[model samples]
Target: MKPGTSTQSALPKLVTCPTCGGDSVYAPSNPFRPFCSERCKNIDLGAWASEDFRMPTTGLPEDQKTDDEQ
Candidate 1:
């Protein structure tokens, strides 16, 4: 164990890819952290671009206006 050296560098952290649900290296060594491969990363990007993934909203009706508008 050398000074300023961390044990984290010795072993790669394993994580599940969001797109494929597979094991992925969550480290700088892997260009695609949290993703198994570029293919999986790209697929996630495509889903975002196509609006397949969405954030939860309050579901306010279009007819109703916000207080800011008043």
Candidate 2:
């Protein structure tokens, strides 16, 4: 190792938690990375389920809803 460089520097940088923006450890070695733990992971999952995330649609097929309905 170089005099100024340490083994810790070789390791990945610390990541911030997505949900709470808190300090998080790099868990790339584990399957659940980016998230600090299972709890934070679940919180993100819940947001997806609750429609906090949305995908835009140009318009429904003409057959679906009438012109009066947007």
Candidate 3:
């Protein structure tokens, strides 16, 4: 054990930004991690807000759907 040591790991992990496909720091030091920058983060956010990213759904009507579909 050393004096004045941190519990956090010394090495930070690097990850690919989803929006820009660039390298990003996956640590607390990077506020907009996993997205590279605010622009890329916002772009991803906008996509979500605009319903561009969604889960797959069946094209059946709600009334015709079975109990499993609910």
lDDT of 3 by residue, 1-70 (tens): 7998866677688999999899999988899987789999999999999999999986877569778866
Encode model 2's per-residue lDDT on 10-48: one tens digit a residue: 777678989878767775664456877788889999999
Compared with the true structure, what per-residue lDDT tens digits does model 1 show for residues 2-70? 797879668888999999999999988899887999999999999999999999897778899889877
Whole-model Cα lDDT per candidate?
Answer: 0.91, 0.79, 0.88
Q: Cα-based RMSD of the predictions, in order?
A: 5.0, 4.9, 5.6
The TM-score leader among the candidates is: 1
Write down the worst ten-residue block by lDDT for model 1: 1-10
Score every model by TM-score. Answer: 0.70, 0.57, 0.68
Look at candidate 3 and give me any clashing residue pairs: none
- Ranking of all candidate structures by their lDDT, best first: 1, 3, 2
| Runs of candidate 3 exceeding 4 Å displacement | 1-8, 61-70
Clashing pairs in 2: none
